[model samples]
Target: MHIAEGFLPPAHAVAWGVASAPFVVHGVRSLTREVREHPESTLLLGASGAFTFVLSALKLPSVTGSCSHPTGTGLGAILFRPPIMAVLGTITLLFQALLLAHGGLTTLGANVFSMAIVGPWAGYAVYKLLRRSNVPLMVTVFFAAFVADLSTYCVTSVQLALAFPDPGSGFLGALGKFGSIFAVTQIPLAVSEGLLTVLVMRLLVQSSKGELTRLGVLVAQKQARTGTETEAVGR
Candidate 1:
């Protein structure tokens, strides 16, 4: 969800910018460290950024000053963690704001805070929780992507509500209005994004098993099995 340029009050805009700066700065360091330490992961990182850009760019008109779309942050968060996904999501949002006019420069901070920071962290938390409970990998992936996509809109609704509270009902009313409107389109989109993420992960599993293993997405059991199989063959 991208808030239109100049739509939010100046104070709100600056406040959001100030709040978002630290996460983005930390994300930059995380990304740099990831690239430096695992040069082979460069390709996957690029793909994750591209996925976020493409999916988020396919926006649909929604509430005033905002739109609905799939936030492809879950896959990257799952693979490289939320800190790294924050960098990818920020780059995607910035480029879209400049070249595609998908979002506005003024609202970049708010959008980044929602889609890049909160969404990934929330989704990754769910993923980790479910995985610890022994959830199937694909199922964990689906819920993670679903939560990531939906949570961005939820945060956007809160931001909009806070910026423009309803005259009669105040902030709660405004939040309800915005949240209801966002849910109309975002729910299905979230489900679609979840399924799509699962599909992409399946392909990655088949084609980049080693990479997934290194990222800890594929876990250790498969690697152990492969090693055991190799030893058996040798025997």
Candidate 2:
């Protein structure tokens, strides 16, 4: 979700900027370290950034200042972790804001906080949790992408609600209204994103199995083969 330029009050914008600065800074460092340590990963890193840029740019009309879109942060978060995804997300948002006018410079911080920071972390958390519970890889990938896409809107709703509380009903009421409006479009978008992410992951599984295994997205071949045999015997 991209909040339009000058949509948020000055005070709210500054506050969100201040809150988001540290995460972006840390993300920069994380990205730098990743590149320095694993130069081979640079291609995949670029791919991840491209994915976020392309997917998030496909915006649809929604709330007054914001729009609904698929957040493509989940794949990067799953592959490279949230810290690196944060940097990629920020880059995508920045370019969109500058070139497409999809979002504004004034509201970049709030948008970054929601889509870049919270969305990736929340998705990655769900992915890790589900994987730990032994969920199938594609299933985990789907939910991770689904949660990432949905969580961005949830945070956007909160941001908008806090900034423009309903005069008669107040913050809670505003939150409910904003949340509901977003959900109408966001739920379907999230499911669509989830399926798309699963498809992408499947391709990666076939073509980039070594990299995926190195990134821990897939188990080592030996381990996977053993697990498959174990399941066969169990059946």
Candidate 3:
């Protein structure tokens, strides 16, 4: 999801930085709270971040003549929450840039804003809105991933427009091009990502019933056991 260096103007870069600062701060704060409240969540966050870093680097064909990859922010948001996922995503992006040069340093903030901030938040909102037990989790994952991927592309187009405000290269034109490009590629990618996320979630739910408990998604017997242990120790 890197916009490639020089695609965006300096003004656009600065503008995105300014716009994303508050969200980044919020994400950090949320991550901190989650870690403190449920230390095991950090393990899942790190695992997911590592997987995202690896998964997103795999190239797939795109109509725009550039390769695209799954952002995986939607999966993170669905499993955790958007703000915490944003922080985890930023960390993963940082590692990708440093280790693989998948993205440039100059455009890192813009990339994070588009993929981590926009994608995760939008996906989480959609998933929450459409996802009742009545709906299949896999179906919800597909729709959320689809919307999230498209939303990231839309944010990237706007970021590019901010950088290139030439009359012929207006934001609308940028948006139109992005809409077409994503329409061609995002569906397949979204379906793959959604299926993968659901599969992983199913495995996790089965193997680690205490996990969502650690996330405060539910109370598990482990908590009761821990409490009993604490009382025994106290007595």
Off by over 4 Å in 1: 60-67, 222-235
Candidate 3 structure lDDT: 0.72
Which scores higher on TM-score, 1 or 3?
1
Query: CA shift at 86, candidate 2, in angstroms?
Result: 0.8
> Model 2: per-residue lDDT, tens digit, 1-235?
6889999999999999999999999999989988998798999899888888778877655544455789899999999999889889989889889998977899999999999999999999999999989999999999999999999989999999999999999999999998887755698788888998899889888888877766777777677577644543542
Per-residue error at 25 for model 1, in Å? Answer: 0.7
Off by over 4 Å in 3: 62-66, 213-235
In order, the Cα lDDT scores of the candidates are 0.87, 0.88, 0.72
Which residue pairs overlap in candidate 3's backbone? Answer: 9-163
TM per candidate comes to 0.90, 0.90, 0.82
Better of 2 and 3 by TM-score: 2
The TM-score of candidate 3 is: 0.82
- Which 10-residue window of candidate 2 scores lowest in summed lDDT? 226-235
For 39-97, candidate 1 gives per-residue lDDT tens digits of 99999999998889778877665444455689899999999899889889999889888
